[model samples]
Target chain A: MIRSLHIAAKDLKAEFRTKQMLNSMVIFSLLVIVIFSVSFGDLLGDSETVSQLAPGVLWIAFTFAGMLGLSRSFASELENGCLEGLKLCPVDRSAIYTGKAISNVVIMFLVELITIPLFAVMFNYNIQGLLGLVVVIVLGTIGFISVGTLLSALTVNTGTRELLLPILLLPIIIPVIIPAVLATGKILVNGDISDISGELRLLLVYDIIFFVIAQLVFEYAIGD
Target chain B: MSTNSQKINILSILTAIVMFIAAYMIFFYLPQMRDTSGQLLDSSFKIFYFHLPIAITSYLAFFVVFVASILYLKKGTHNWDVLARSAAEVGSIFALLVLVTGSIWAKATWGWYWVWEPRLTTSLALFLVYLAYLMMRQAIEEPEKRARLSAVFGIVGFASVPLSFLSIRMWRSAHPLMFGPSAQGSSGGLEGTSLQFTLIVNFIAFFLLFATILAYKVKNENLQEEINAKKQALP
Candidate 1:
């Protein structure tokens, strides 16, 4: 755990210095939000329905952005040949997996936080649901990043990883996406934890399940 | 060569006969669901016979992949790798068939091409999972690494099936009864004697068909391996 934290801290310091993954995800998310606002502008007469659709739209943007961040999480390591250096260390492989996953989640969380307000302003929506949206985003991001981290490791060594990462990652993440999207929509509407308890519980379940599975399989994935 | 030719001929003949019988049962033998006025709406409902069997066989195909993958990881044998690949290919083919037939049936029953319903969505997810598996297998060039990576993926992919099914079912509330009769998706869908018999026969026929296809696929892979070995020996 300590070693994992060191790895996470290392990645965090590097990410803060460069912010390559961070920049693209933020810009990509804003693009998605703008596109969605344009697409839905003509359909709905009132802002109420559009506001309600915010959660779904927000998630779609976050997911697309998250995909790029996940793929790039290991790309740096691959390019710099750092994975071999890490593998040569007397450390459990899963520590590296967990470390990368945590960094991905943090980076994704920052992206989501920035996107929410812009998303609200662009769509003419209220920020009363901002806190709830944050919670949903946190839970959803952790679940997705956990799976994405392992998959990035799996495909990072493969050819055309840009294509392989999303192809393999998306289908497995469907179970996570369904519950998270449903829960987010509910939370945005009611702005309370009690009402969306089912979605919340399902999201937690999905997060834990995928997180543990990633840990167990991380060895087989990158084991030489 | 003569024995091999004769074996192929027998398997091909058996598969053809069983396929025809299945087709016949679907069209002529199965009892159609009775309408509100007790009239038979028999023709298009026949797709259910083929539809459900193919779905079951697709699941069976994945089951083979799961077992073979486990064996490959355990024994590190080339045979298990080949079997896993064959099963995955056949499985993806059936999964695609299930989607096409399902879409056709959905069009007939729901008056729409697709819905966010549980079973339909779940089957779509399953199809995508196996498609990804195939793509993963192709992405890697090294045979050993490819086999190991895909074996690991095959295991996790199969495990996701139930989670995908449950999450979608719970999230969507209800769209349809999943796998029941066309209009009345409530009860066991197999209402009458003929309907039951036809479903059973078709299932048996599909099992036979699955076996035949898998056998041929594995045989082809083995033959390809022999040819490669012979070329290597020539040098």
Candidate 2:
């Protein structure tokens, strides 16, 4: 566990150093928000509705941006052949998965932090229920990263890694999105946690299930 | 060589006959449409005999791919890889049948051909994922790498099936069966001997049809391998 955390911390530091992945994700997210605001100016004129849609918008941004970041995780590792060095280490392969998943989650959380507030200011929306919303994002991020990390490892060696990850990841992430979107949307509308508790529970279940399965299967997925 | 070819031809003919009989039973013996009140509005509900069975068979085929993928990873045998590919191809075709029969059923019963229902949406995503698997295989130049990579993807892809189903259910879709069929164990849908028998026969028939197609696909792959080996030996 300590080794895994060490690897995770190292990954986080490396990711922040150059910032290619983070920069692109942030820029693309801002562009999406800008396009939405410009095109749906009248549609989102109602501040209340915009606030309600904020959670959905935040998730959408993070989900797409996270896809790029996940693919890049492997792409960057392979470009420098760092995976070989890591594999040569005296660490369990699942630890590698844990490290990568944690790093992906952290990057995705950072992206979410930026976009959620940006969404609020853009639409002049009062975003409350912050705690529930953050929990939803974190759970959803775990769910996405769990599966995404495995697929990234699988696809990175393929001929078209970039094209392959989304095809593989999107379907698996559906279970996560359903509950996350529902819970987040409910919170966005200031709905009580009890009202969306079912979705939250489901999200938690999905995260746990996928994380375990991905860990078990990640070795086979990346095997020779 | 010609005599062996003749034997294989006969087997193909037999499979074709069985498929035709299944189709006949589905279209003629099955009821086509029925109302929600458990009343046989008309015999048009017979299409479901084919529709429901094909859907079930497609899911079964995907499961086979999943199993074969596990075996490939376990043994690293060429045969399991071939089995996975054949299953994927046949699964994709059955998936096509699911879409077609589903649209027909929708048009007859729901007054529209398609709605983004939970089941249908998942089926669509399954089709696309496997179709991409096929495309990825074709894009790669190395057969070994292609087989290995696609097998990995196939196993991962099948995991998505349940996810899509559950997700669609949790988040309501525009599909007519929004709440899904009653789980209260009521005779809400099926009624009468004709409807029940047709549904059962349809399921059996499609199940057999899938088996036959899977056999043919595997055989074709085997023959292609034999030809490649022969050519390589000659050179």
Candidate 3:
């Protein structure tokens, strides 16, 4: 656990010094939002369509941007032999997996922090139930990062790392994305929290299931 | 060239003979199914003879992949990796046939080409997951790493299948089962089997055919591996 924490902190410190991933991801996040707004600009007059579209757009932006940050984290490691150094450490490989996943979840949270409010401000949509929305985002990000991090490792050694990430990820993680989108949309539409409790449970279940499976098998993905 | 290959050839020939018999039974002996009032279902329903059987065979093929993947991870065996690869490719083909035939049946019956029905969506997602496994395999160059990584991916992809189905059913909020609640444990169940005897015979035939194809592919992969190893040795 200490070694895992060390790995996580190492990445976090590096991220702080360079800020390369965060800067690029923030820019990427902004562009995704701008693109979404421009595409939906014509429907700005229709509040109903905007409300319905807002949640989906927010998630699509968050999900794809998270994909970029996750891949870049590993891309750096793969290029600089940091991954090799980490693997040479005398620790359980699952620790490295957990550490990477933790840093990824934190990075995604930071990205979400920037983008979620930006999405609302840019689109002129009101987000209700801030607490509920935050909960939904946290759970949803966990589910996405858990699977995405594992898959990033799996694909890091491959030839087409950039393209293969989304192809392998989107389908397997649909269970997570679908419920998260629905729940977030519900909150955005002024629906009661009671309305999306089922969606919340689905997200929780998905996170736990994938988290366990990914942890148990993480060694297989990156191990020698 | 060897006794094992000779035996596989014989088995494939017998599989062909059995498939022909199944076809004969489907087309010649079995009559078209009729609904009430003496009205016959569309002749397109005859695709059921191949479609349903092949669908089940595809599921069976994926199950083989799941097993072969687990075995590969546990034993680190090249044979199991070959089996898993062959099963995935063959399974994807069968899954594609399912989608095509199911689409045609829908067009004949419902007058539309497609619907986002839960079963259809799950099947489509399942096919994509299968293809993703193959793509992942192609992206890796080293043999051992590719085997290990692909085995993990194979397990993860199959695990996601049931979750994907559940998620779709949950999101759609439908009856959850094709056969409704009342249909459970009843003789007159929902439309699981349209033409029961014909379906059974075809299933048997298709399963044997799946086995033959799997053996043929695995045998050829082994041959290919040997050829590659020998070629590398020549240098």
Candidate 4:
């Protein structure tokens, strides 16, 4: 586990130094939110409309932007031959998956941090129940990035990285998206936690299930 | 060569006959759906027996593919890979049936051919995922690598089934399950011995059809292998 964390920290430092993945994602997310605001300008002027759309905007922005990071993350490892080097190290392949999943989640979580507030401001929504909203975002991001990391490894060796990720990832992550969106929508509308707990629990269950599956399957994806 | 060709021809003829009978039963024997007002609805209710069976079969095919994928990775056998690939191919066709019959059902019941309802949305997502897996295979030139990557995807792709199933439950505030509480277990539309009889026949038909397709695909793969081996030996 500690070894995995070391690998994860190494990835984090490498990601920060290159900044290619992070920069592209951040810019892409911001652009999506900006475009959303412009297209739905009249809709955004209404508090009700903005509140309802906030969760969707945040998810779409985060989900699509995160795809940019996922497709390149492991494919680049294959491109640069870093994957073999990492495999040669004395760590379990599942640990490598764990590390990568952690880094991806961190990057996605940070991106969500920026995108969510921007969405709130652009749409003139307060994001009342901010604490509960953040919990939903964190859980949802966990579910998204867990599945994303596993899929990135699978698609890394495919011919077209760009086309494969969304087609492959979107279908698999629907469970994550539904509950995340529902929970966030509820929080946005100021619904009681009692009303939204079912959705939240579903998201948590999805996150745990995918997290475990990704760990077990990571070895096959990375191995020849 | 003549004998092998003759066998395949016979298989094709048998499949054709079975399918013809299935279609005849679907169009003739199925009862029309009556709304709450006791008015007999249009002939479109005929699409239900066809649509629901195809949908159920497609879901079953995906699950089979998922299990086969896991076995392929564990055993590293080409046979399991063949099974997985064949299941995926037939599953895609069934998915097509699901989409078409679903559209027809929607037109009959909801007055719109496509509503993006929970079940429809999930099935659409399943169709797209299956297509993506096939496309991924086509995109790869290396056979072994293609099989490995696709198997991994096949395993992961199924994870979305439940997600799509639950999405409707989460998002729709007003619309409840048509039949019951369980997301996919609702028997609202089908009642009495009719439901049981239809379900059993559909399962048998789908299974036989599935086996026929699987055999054909495996034979094709074997032929391709033989041709490849012959060409390599000549050189």
| lDDT, candidate 1, at B227 | 95
Instruction: Note the DockQ of each predicted structure.
Output: 0.60, 0.46, 0.64, 0.64
TM-score of chain A of 3: 0.96
User: Residue A176 error for model 3, in Å?
Assistant: 2.4
Tens digit of per-residue lDDT, candidate 1, span A33-73: 99998988774557678756877888889889999898888
User: What are the per-residue Cα lDDT tens digits for candidate 1 across B44-76?
Assistant: 677888888998899999999989988988889
Model 4 C-alpha lDDT per residue in residues A1-224, reported as the tens digit of each score: 89888877998898899898888899899999999899987886678777777778878998899999988878877756788998898888898898888888888887877777787778787666777887888888898898899988887776787787888888777767867887888887875667688778888888898898888888888766
- How far does residue A212 in candidate 3 sit from its true spot (Å)? 1.6
- Please give, for every candidate in the order listed, the TM-score of chain B alone compared with the true chain B: 0.88, 0.81, 0.87, 0.82
Docking class of 1: medium
Chain A TM-score by candidate, in order: 0.95, 0.94, 0.96, 0.95
Model 2 Cα lDDT, one tens digit per residue, A131-204: 77777888888988988898898888778778878877776676677568768878878656677877888878
Q: Could you give the DockQ of candidate 1?
A: 0.60
TM, every model: 0.89, 0.88, 0.89, 0.90
- Candidate 4 docking class: medium
| Runs of candidate 3 exceeding 4 Å displacement | B24-40, B167-188, B191-194
Clashes within 3 Å, all models in order = 0, 9, 0, 1
Chain B TM-score against the true chain B, candidate 1:
0.88
What are the C-alpha RMSDs, in order, of all predicted structures?
3.2, 3.3, 3.2, 2.9
Cα deviation at A98, candidate 1, in Å, is: 1.4
The ten-residue window of minimal lDDT in model 4 chain A covers A190-199
Q: Pairing residues by index, what is the TM-score of model 3?
A: 0.89
